[model samples]
Target: MNEGNTALTWHVDLSDQKLPRLLLRLAIPSVIGLSINALQQALNAIFVGSLGAQAIAAVSMTMPIIILLGAIGEGIGVGTASFISRHLGAGDEAEASRGASTALALAAPAGLIMTVALLAILRWVFIALGASPTILPIAIDYATILLPGSTLMLLTIVSGFIVRAEGSTRFSMWTMLIAFILNAALDPIFIFLLGLGVRGAALATMLSQIAAISFYTGYFIKRTGTVLVSISQVSLRVDLIRQLALIGAPATTTSILAALAGMFLYGATARFGDDFIAAVGIAVRILTIGALPITGFCIGSQAVLGFGWGARDFARVVKVAKLMVSITVSLSVVYSAAVVAFARPLVKLFSDSDNVTEIAVLSCIVFHLFFGFYGIQSFVTTMLQSLGRARLSAVVSFARQGYLFIPAVLLFPGISGFSGVLASQAVAELGAGMIALFVMLRQFAELRQGARDP
Candidate 1:
């Protein structure tokens, strides 16, 4: 068979695979990739933790801003993935290529603009993010290297999503693995041997991201994938951009809201002391690491659901969603139990301070009590995006971190003190999970009806 036929066969084979096997095939690599990424973050924290509480706090302060920068790329990536997968499912490779190309073309400028704009106001931004005076300089040192290199990060993220949408998840996994391994190796060398401290950690991350984007560049350049993204195919077509934006806006808003919520949480925690800030930081990192499997599965399922929806195979979509929800919720429960069971030991891994350890332990247990709620929220959000229900997705996204979380974080701490701060996320997750369940049930009904209709 010709190469064209081979490509078509590959795409068709993805849709033909058994549901359980297909999801596992896709999700396992993503889980491994994301887990490694999370492990790297944990390692970064440990490396910085040795610098003292102030160093940890400084690095933590940079997180919100870094997340804000990441939001752009993630939004674009999600938009590109959804657009490409659906088009490919419909057997329009040209459209898929065009959409992918347009997204890639847009990523660089977006990253560049953010880098310049953010660097200009770095100090003020950190101050607004509640960085204490002592932590401000270290935060600046870290972000300076990171912000400028974010363009590479954007390219790497968008490219990974593009390949994953094409069911080339192993390639996506390799990219992440390469970056993580490199970052892990460099962390000690840069941070300690080189005495760069927080700045060294930032440098390692930037270099690793650079390597990742290089791999992506070579993959696309070699045209090793079915969707060939090239500058020649790039288009500034208004409709395509609008379509991307429609899907992307909600994802971007979701991330931006999380960043804003982080800022608010940091500010509230700061009122207690730098130790509290450090404790919250460690708890956040641990929770993030723990959530990787659920998130990885949700991400993997996106390609499957998008393809099914595009093919008008409502049964497949429904089955995938059901299976995804079951697995993710179960994983959340197990992870939450494990974390609660060993919260103190986990907290001690990052710090030796009795005060920091105690606060982090409490934060871990409180933050994860309703984590199964997060599983529900995450899957539902991914389901909506995959099905092209942009408006609904946007609403659900805002409800969690925006409407619900912002209020809880703002008011709860005042009502209950530090304990209230710890409780805010759990409360928000519960509320959001209920909202997500309602929406998801409605979705299931619609999908079932669609399946029966013609």
Candidate 2:
């Protein structure tokens, strides 16, 4: 590693071999890193579950709002990743740094605004999400403490994107290493030993995010890299922000819709009690775990395709996108079976209460009925984003998270309550996956022909 070129280091030699081999090289590490994150969050939820149902329910309600704001981080980081990856592919280092600088400049304000608005919305956010009065106090306390720190989280995310796009996965991985370990270690101590209750949980999370901030910030400043997006590089201009947001906004908003949809699901299932809510929360975390492979492949393809698009390597982009969809869908069969086979033990990992366990186990199977299809959807949407096919990707994004999922949540609960709510997610995924598959196939064909899409 060249000490002076830390930022430029990611602009490495990409092998021109078979696409599957290349995708695997990227996907394996991404899977490990994403799994590590999932494990960290699961640990917190597991430990908190031991404290009782309200504690679990409190965390559950707080998650939607936290994740809602987390959209900025995902969106901005992705923008950075998209721009930097392409710049690297084009063999342009200086522009990549400027994009990196601009990303941070933009991320800072988004984080700041989220911090303040969440402060005022803390009480109402939960209430709006159908949180009952009994649990509202604890939920508010947790959200209030953790919400303000969303800014640091956004910075940390974009920083990782910049570094990773520069072909510095090791550095990006190491940063997560430090933050995840710190967060995991402090979680048990703060929640149990310090007896901080919900506040303890928030404190642990806050400290971890702040540490991530320091680790990433120090990496750029102290690293001998030319990624110095200085005061001059920072901009609040409409063009830069617009470009970044165009790519990121859809991904971010997709996550926001998921959070918002959770609220509707909550309303539908509330009659069953907090146990159901807590069970659903646990189910989500577990489901997300299984989807990691799909997520990783999507991200990996984004890099490959985004770069290909930037360089007018249309053939490579087409091959990569088609291969990614095929490989991901094939892998999903294995993932779904594994989950269904071990659903019982997986549910027990989160809660011992028979009622919670029962609901969780059942929810796990039902929620993932169309599990394989999620891979198809992830592959298509990520490919579109990487290729800067924003219009197509945005459609993929909105169909699954906003249009299909949200409406299902509202309509299903009215007809069938718990069953309806659970079924709605599977329906949305199934619908989106089918549509994305058709569109992705069509796009790949168009790319190969060097013809404009109709």
Query: Which candidate leads the pack in TM-score?
Result: 1
Q: lDDT tens string, model 2, 294-336?
A: 7866776666777777777887887787787777888786778
Q: Can you give the TM-score per candidate against the true fold?
A: 0.97, 0.93
For every candidate in turn, the CA RMSD to the true structure comes to 1.9, 2.5
Residue 147 in model 1: shift from native, Å? 0.9
Error of 1 at 116 (Å): 0.9
- Candidate 1 on 1-454: residue-level lDDT in tens? 4645544433324586599999988888889989988998899999999999999999988888888888999999998999988987898999999999999999999999999999999999888877888888999999998888999988888998898899888778888999999999999999999998999999999999999999888878867678989999998999999999899889999889989999999988998989999999999999899788788999899999999989999989999999999999899889989999999999988998898999899999998888877788889988898888899998777887899989999999999999889888988878888999899999999999999999
Candidate 1 regions with alpha-carbon error over 4 angstroms = 1-12
Give the C-alpha miss distance for residue 171 in model 1, angstroms: 0.6
Worst 10 residues of 2 by lDDT: 7-16
